[model samples]
Target: MFETVLKCTKCGKEYSLASGIYKCEKCGAPLDVQYDYDSIRDLIEDNDSWFREPPRVWKYWMFYPVSNLRKIVSLNEGGTRLYRMKNLEKKLGFGKLYVKNEGENPTGAFKDRGSSVEITKALEFHAKKVVVASTGNMAASVSAYGSKAGLEVTIVVPEGTPIGKLVQAVVYGAKIKIHGSTYDESLAESERMAREEGYYLTGNYHYRVEGQKSTGFEIFDQLRFDSPDWIVVPIGAGTHLRAIWKAAKEFYELGLIEKLPKIAGAQIEGYDAIVRAWKERKPITPIKEKKPTVASAIAVKAPVDGENVIKAIDESEGYLGAVTNEETMEAGMMLGKEGLFVEPSSATALALAKTMREEGIIDKDESVVIVATGHGLKDIKTWESFIKL
Candidate 1:
């Protein structure tokens, strides 16, 4: 196992990996996992055989913070297809366009990637119970993984989460608590439980960010270690976009990729705190009132990783914007036409990509990749209501 340390993202404080702390004690900010990159670079340079292994989350195990291979509780997540949208490319008049379909994971959502790592780390810490707060996807994912690891799982969700998602968690045997009206409230409840009840808190923390970075790794791998011109990702808690940018920088520093791609963040109109902060060049001000939207999965009023996401976008020379529910529905239909059935939240990436291209933020001649985070089936009722089927 390579040497690792937890560094505060806000302050410069560093903690040993053995500390088992997810946030900085000094600044109360999230911590980032830092690895021994020199050894990792040497390992990759010396042996390229691991690259031939089946493309799954564990295929890039070296990049993860987990040291014990046997502790990994995986459902064979990652390695989702990166499909070239030839028809959409021509229709949208882009040089090239692709969709990294994360819906292909075991639990039919991208959250499985983080769950695999989160569960593994929980085991490493000798934790017997795990808790998470989610609008939908993460709850199902963590429940499935926790059940696989033989750990007690508790899920706290906001009111109005899609039934399809909750059913998956129920089937996985997780104790469900419908606590509050919004995701932020549920997150607070979960955190309180973790503090008082010794439950391992699992959500968009640093360890989950480590796992989510695999999406970026797979994208470069499928593209033959090449970086795209723009990579569009939908932001809820803003973890995935930050993770991808971190992955890009890691690969570049390790002498894997020559250049980094511009990261564009997508959000629904009412839940677009990060986008608003980006445009205003200020810190994120939490949204007080939550408005109903089709993209329930991304309806986060107070994004946990908003500041880092803004920093990532600014550093990458990227764009961040919000799209209306109607725009998201149109984008989802467009994806369906191409045989990719994605949830409304996932379609936000495509919606933002269209706007970017139209506004000249993303040039037509540049290669673009839109990350479709979850399957349409994850929110079937939303689709049924809009499609009249």
Candidate 2:
């Protein structure tokens, strides 16, 4: 088992493993799940053979902070396919393009990976009820996993959540609460509900970030345990970006990888808080009123973990960029042409990649891995426009 601690990313303060706290008491910044790397290295050395087994994320069980395997409520969330886009590479003239399709997850999005671990942690803490706020994907993931464990589930969603993901949460029997116009408002309500109603809030928790780190683990494994030059992902709350960076650092410390890959984040035009903060070289200020865009999933008015996200980008020598709604839809259509249909937010990765390549920010010789975070089926209504063509 790992000796884990919840450490604040900003203030470097540590909390007990069983503290059940999500943020730092001192600074309010997001906490990271830090492990005893030396112990982890020793374990890997002792059980070297078992590391090659299947079921991707679980293969890295020693990396997770959970003390009891019995408490893990998994739906085989990780181990998604890594697709080599040779045709895309030729078309875009980029070096070694690939797509890590997280849409293959049971709930049709990458949020399942985090929700699986978060729900398990809630069960471990003996919580009877759990709550989450999401644009759509996280709500659905939590609802499904929470229902499987027979825990009461309550979800807060913004008014315009995509119909398909909303339907998933409903069918999973979660009591849905419709909140403010933006995802940020819903999250605010969820936080209040957690404090007053004593519901175990799971979204944006440190353990959830640990679970999402499995995507980085899977990408490394799929690439034969080598580091790519760039790993692009769509940014919402920005936890996934930080999680990927955490996994890479863990791999580097364990001597599994020589260096960390650049962690680039893509956001749609209207929901680019992290990008704006990065460009300004200042703290993030939440957008008061967000504009409408097809990329509903990543349309967060405020990213709670914005500071950590900026730190990850800076530490990894990465950049954050945004694309217009037209560009997002165009990228989604291009993926559809490749027989890979993904949500608009997921397509933003490709949109960023294309932009970087055209602007000469991305070298033609460097390998690139784009993360398609959700399935197009989750936002099937958006695909009707592409179908009309």
Candidate 3:
């Protein structure tokens, strides 16, 4: 059995393990699973020798919240390629550049890491079904893994999501609800179903958070260090940003790293919910249906984790930046030229870094890491418009 610890970040209350429900009863904020680290330090000290055994996220199973490895369903998600960019470094004027290429996951996106854990929890609880509201990447990831776990799956996506991702959800046989002019629109629609159907919601699930934290573990393992100088991530619903922050903070607390890296949150200007919250020092005003952008994947009008995401940014002293549709497209093309064909939303990071370079916000000599969240092929239909060849 796992240490199976659970704690409320809001109310300092603890809940029974395997509650089959995730929210804190007292405060209603999401619960984070706690693990006993008395044994973890010695166990993970020889990180390289240990990690070479399992190439996937599950390699760090002891650090993750999941208890039973056998019950865990996986698509061999995570352990994505980390590329050092001499080419991108020169262009961006950084001393070092690393791309955590997440497109190679089972569903061709980083969301697979969360999907693997969510499905495992669903199986453990014998959940009636698995459901998630996603723009593009998460819908496809949840549908694909839910299929593997033999769970009844439903995916909610915005109508304007890329055609390829929509088609994947369709062909995967998951019940699909296409709503919202944007990702947050579909999220609202999914919330209704989640409340009525008792399906496990991925974004709101503790297991998903536990599983997604593996990305941070893998990054540390890859760097052979605690963390990098900066980690640039594209944010739609802010769960990933929150997870990255959580993991890095955990590692630092456990003496893994002396310092935590700045978690840079990237957004397309029109769908910049977290950005606005950061600047104004207040809660985000919900916008249901946002206009389209080439960075369609991160185009959520209102992300559910807005408050916690801003807390992560403000507490970490991290900054936020917006990349325009034109800048996003250009950055995507530049990545393609460097042999990285990431989705436009993923390119938002590179664009932000470039903009930061101009402003001298980020020093040229610091090591920077960019998270490329999905495969470019998901939005291939729009690629012809920007492709140089």
Candidate 4:
């Protein structure tokens, strides 16, 4: 009811919330969902009261893009715990280190956040089915939501997509399509299907991004409206990073919070798209590539929003960090040792933070929150080495 609709990030052109247009052809850039701040201000004035109403992410529905609450398909996701790293912080020698554990969501990862809104929007578009090319987690998420919405789900995964992700997707009753040798190939095939067919694209949909951004909103809420000094997020498709940065900016613009937090992105070295753009020292390039990574979920060769990811880092005064597969797995094991079980993709952010801290790139006293993007169960294949046979 309080929707202000979609606005192109580059051209400022506005479209109706129900328009179903995801990008701006006028400026050839991504579009973002905007809201009526006046209405949001009134609805979320007493944020604590809103939290008392629901144990899910939709509690912030007043600020998101969904028009009909009835169309929402959720797995009771988006209320993940923000963990205070005690011994791990002590071991890392950090004064204040925290992690937003996103694996606890209904389908076992953060993808549920975006997938929930995506399915709702698809229903709004009267879509009979939804489709996606996933490294693993997104496919499973789409399938779960599609099942709940009584729609079909088509999923494309890389040939080597880990066993757990494939199982999850199949269990949710998706038509699994295995494709090329890498994640990028599958993403391309999925996009082509959506373009040629009528299935709605969920991963990069503006509304999907709007829903995922609520994680950032919840992070602030969990912190009692205090923006952390630094936020390190795992960058796969750039949606999570882009959404968080957008949400923080909105919060600041709406006078709900003060300043935006410096948002750093973590990428595995083998499949670093945003990293290449950040290091180029040129105008941001078209996100393109062959996906590669041991932490397979974040292994994207090219993400659609490379420029936006770099811009978010620049605007927030943060830098890019890449971790090796070995480091990521170690970080995952370390997280488990700390009693936080998160997938390796999530570990990438924490691993890079550890690397940065040791390299003197990051100061110890700074307040930081690492975004653990998925649960460990999604990538259980990597756990055997670290956990001992």
Q: By lDDT, who's the top model here?
A: 1
Model 2: which residue pairs collide? Answer: none
For model 3, residues 1-389, the per-residue Cα lDDT tens digits are 44556887668688777665557788777777887776777677757587456447888787676668888888889989889988878977987888899998888888889888888877777776877886467777888888888877888877655565667876766887777776556777776777788887766466777788877877887887558888888988777888888889878877877889888889897888778778887778866555768887787776666676788887787889888989998888888877899888899988998788778878888888889998898778667777676
For candidate 2, write residues 1-389 as lDDT tens digits.
68567888889999998887768899988888777889888888888676577646678887887779877888878889999988889999888999999999999999888888888888888989998887488888999999998899998888976566678888988998889987668888998888888899979879889889999988987887789999999998899988999889998888888878998999898788889889988778887775888887888877877888888988999989999999989988888788898988899999999999999889999899999999988888777765663
Per-candidate clashes, comma-separated: 0, 0, 0, 1
Residue 340 of model 4 has an lDDT of 86
lDDT of 1 by residue, 1-389 (tens): 77478898888799998987767899888889988999999898888786566567777788898878987898889989999999999998778999999999999889999899989999999999999987588988999999999999999988876666688899998998888987778889999888899999999899999899999998988888899999999999899999999999999999889999999999998988898888988889888886889998898888888989988998999989999999999999999999999989999999999988888888879999999999999988899899874
Give one digit per residue, the lDDT tens place, for model 4 in 74-111: 77888788889988888997768999999888888888
Candidates sorted by TM-score, descending order?
Answer: 1, 2, 4, 3
Where does candidate 2 stray beyond 4 Å? 158-165, 179-182, 386-389
Instruction: Give candidate 4's total backbone clashes.
Output: 1
Full-model lDDT, candidate 1: 0.90
TM-score of 1: 0.97
Off by over 4 Å in 4: 11-13, 46-48, 51-55, 158-164, 178-185, 283-292, 385-388
Model 1 bad stretches (over 4 Å): 158-165
Q: Per-candidate TM vs. native? A: 0.97, 0.96, 0.90, 0.91
Q: In the order shown, what is each candidate's alpha-carbon RMSD?
A: 1.4, 1.6, 2.6, 2.5
